[model samples]
Target chain A: MKRVIFGSSWLPYAFLAPQILIVIIFFYLPAAEAVRASFYLENPFGGGSTFVGIDNYKDVLTDDNYVRVAKFTFWFSLLVTFFSLAIALLLAVKADTVLRGAKSYRILLMWVYAIAPPVAGLIGVLMFDQHVGPITDVAALFGYKMQIGVNYNDTAAAMIIISIWKQVPVNFIFFLSGLQSIPKAVREAAQIDCRSSWRRFWTVTFPMLAPTGFFLLIINITYALFDTFAVIDVVMKNEPGSNPMTLVYKVYLDGFRGSDLGGSSAQSVILMALVLLLTIFQFRMIERRVHYT
Target chain B: MMETTSSNLEVEARAGGRRTPLLSQRRFWRSVGDHTVLWLGVLFMLAPVLLAFLTSTHDAVTIHRDGLQFLPGDHFGETYEAVLFGATGFTGKATGLVMTFNSMVLGIGFAVGKIVISMMAAYAIVYFRIPFATLAFWVIFTTLLLPLEVRILPSYEIVQKMGLLNSYTGLILPLIASATGTFFFRQFFKSVPDELLEAARIDGAGPFKFFVDILVPMSKTMIAAIFIIMFVFGWNQYLWPTLITTDEGYYTLVRGIKQIIQVWVGANIPEYGQAMALAILAMLPPILVVVVFQRWFIKGLTESDK
Candidate 1:
């Protein structure tokens, strides 16, 4: 895009070679390998592989446990995305409104963003530990026993909670930045025209935030799909037996632990397709967005 | 982050002065309600980590009996000392100090490698003319669609084929293949004024000189911001490190979180105290970086992704 450009064919390629070589070796090679491996029935014990067209995909899609895991993944993504976004939006709105201790609130609400997912899960595990968990003790007070990593729903609930907790800071940052970027003229106009603050927020503030919200929706869904792998892995205590897991975790379990390379590759290809669809959908939304400026 | 808006201050001042008692009371209650919501949110974020820190101070037996401690205990010094300096882990070689070193290597190496390579790549694409430039750009940026997680198996096999397992290069190289940094730098380089390049050309400055003299200096803040974000990302990485590093010596602090719980399992009361201490050590550096360089961190995070 530079008007005054350097015209050196070898120099450009020389500079690009490292990034391109890395991409080919790591990204492209593995991705192509995944797609190719998906079509084969490969033995894990160092043997020949049979080119079994779509059977691996068929096996994955038709298994009952796979179906169950898929259902849980869907619900997990939805619940994590919805709760994290909602809590972040509420916090951002309140933080933006309050003049007292606002900076303190902003810092406190978002510092947890630096904690890794597994670390968050570790804290969650301690919080929901069977013996030493304060949250478990609180649950006992309420007559609801919490058995994380043992009871299916209890483990799922804990994972979701920790995932949401880890994710809130990210969403909060984006929403707060979005709220701050809203023009003062529009805000004052809304203040004069609308008597009810709630109504004003819905009509003026919320509409202005639709772009950020849309951007974050895709981000949150992608997050729930992949980045929560650490939390799920840690909370399931490294053995995901009948515990709920996102699709990403299942791929790891089947591929690495289970050593079903062909089957895992099939799942990988499926996830790649899913991600591509989501990204394309996101781009479409961005293209169609009504730019305020 | 929370700038004091003059308009908001003026509105609050008006609400407090000469307003009807009824209106002022309602305004005060609304402010109180706002503060309450924020407090709950802060508490929700803080309590788990606070409990983790507090529980880290107690000895294993006490923690096992008392649940998570609400307050610090006397065993804090011993716990932290043992984790940091004492020979621990299944191999007795993966002390917290060693893991922390590995984590720092990964973080700093990843950020520096990414920024350097991405700058080169972006500089080539933006400032040079090449026949296969479009193809290179497309191939590089397409990495954004499929994350490393999706192709973990194949990637592992590839790394295995290359025998990169247990090496620092293996840990860092494959992860940096993505074009996140390139994409960011490309956008930034495009925004840079064309006149600078023209002037440099007029001054007979070659591409390398122009890049070194003008662009790199201009990109100082950008590099710093990206460094912080990438440092946190590399330090926080769990899945990749979990797979590639079979050696105990290569365990990163984030990757070691699962290990603490897994190894100590059924060892009587388990070393809950040390585990929490390790977790604290894992989180502290990145948290400090983000909180300290908050503005640059936010910019790197919020801008780079887009």
Candidate 2:
């Protein structure tokens, strides 16, 4: 798009060769293979593959367990996106209000962003350890036993809590930036027009932050769907039930553990379609609001 | 808003002469409320890690028997030493130190590889006239939609066919061609002034020379920011490495920490202390990077979206 150009086409090709080769080999080739494999029954032992003509898709779509996992994934994504964004917005509002030690508060809150999801899971395990975890002991003090090992709901709750904890820093940073980006004059004008702080925030500030909120909504859902794989894996490692499986975890489980190549590939294709829709939505819908200012 | 409100309050206080005490009292209470909530938020975020750190210092038997320990224990050196240098009692493989080394290698390799390749691709797209360049960019951009989790099965097949299982090249190469980095670099390069390139051309510098001499130097901050993000991302990868590496020698710290817990079956106590220690160790580098490069990390997140 620039007016300036280097005319040597070979040089450009030479520069682009490594990236193009890697993308073709790693990304495009595998993606094409996944799409192809979704339509076929492939033997796990590398014997051969037979074209099944949508049978794989039919099986996956009809499976009750797959439907359950999809439902769980939907709720998990919703809870995580909502709580993380809400808590982060609250903290950002509080932090924005303070005139002293704001930098210290930001730094303290931001370090959690660096902790990986798996590591966060490990911390969650330690914090909610059935025998030695602090939270379990606290629950005991209240006469309510918190058994993550046996209870499916507890396991799900642990997964959601850890996911939200890990996600909060990123959301907090974005929300803080969003809060700061609102011009002071607009808030003052709203304050002069509206007497109550609640009304001012609801009318002027929250509407102004809608774009950031929507952007974080898409991002948080994407993250909970794909990035919390380790959290779920760690939390459910010792459990004897299949109730906590997210869709991505189901892909790994069905493909690798159960050795159902065609079924898992079909699931993968469906997941790919879902992600494709999310990506297109993010770019085509949310991008306009992102660049509005 | 804050300045205007405060100034207005001060004006009213001077006029009334008795509202000064009330105004100061409100300010005092507001600060107290602010600090209280901020500290509570900090505790909510940090208590888990703090508890993990405390648990890491205690002996395994004590932790299992006595529930949770509120205070630091004296076994810090012994537990960390064993966890870092000694193998798990069950598997006589590498220690957490080795896994940490493998993780460091993967993280650095992944970050540096993505930065180099993406910069070259971006330079080509932005600085030169090439055929199908827009198409190439879009093709790379579409890879963002196909995360490794979505295409795990065939990606594993591709790696298996290439005989890259359990190798560093297998670990890093497939994950390195990131669209985020390429898009980020392209946007950064597009923002570079046209006059600079024109001047460089007038001075008889070739594209390669100009790139190395001028553009790379100019992009140091962007590179640093991207490096922090990509390194943390690479270090935190779970599913890809779990599928690719079958050998214990290639186990990353993230995967190794999980293995430590998973391998302990039956009557074994699961070495909660060492696992906690390893978790802490795994978290150190990325946390350090974030604390040190806080500004760049923020810029990487906010700017890359744009």
Clashes of 1: 1
List ranges where model 2 is wrong by over 4 Å: A44-46, A238-240, A290-292, B1-19, B265-267
Cα lDDT of model 2 by residue, A1-293, tens digit: 88988887577888888888999999989888878888999877788999998999999999998998999999999999999998898899889987656788899998998888988987887788787788888888999798875787888899999999999999999989998999989878887899876677788888888888878888898899999998988887644375586999998888888889889889989998998888788777676786656
Quote each prediction's TM-score.
0.97, 0.94
Q: What RMSD value applies to candidate 1?
A: 2.5
Chain B TM-score by candidate, in order shown = 0.94, 0.91
What lDDT score belongs to each candidate, Candidate 1 first?
A: 0.89, 0.85
- What is the per-residue lDDT of model 2 for residues B1-306, given as tens digits with 9 covering 90 to 100? 345435544554455455577766665566567667777889999888888888889998998898657789999999988877888552468788888999999999999999999999889888887779889888888876778888878888889999999999999999975588889999999999999999999999998899999999999999999999899999989888888887988988887756755764354576777778888998999999989999999998888862
Q: List iRMS for all predictions.
A: 1.9, 2.7
What DockQ, between 0 and 1, does each candidate earn? 0.74, 0.64
**Lowest-sum lDDT 10-residue window in model 2 chain A:** A236-245
Query: What is candidate 2's CA lDDT for residue B64?
Result: 84
Docking quality level of the chain pair in candidate 1: medium
What range of 10 consecutive residues in model 1 chain A has the weakest lDDT sum? A284-293
- Backbone clash pairs for candidate 1 read A132-B67
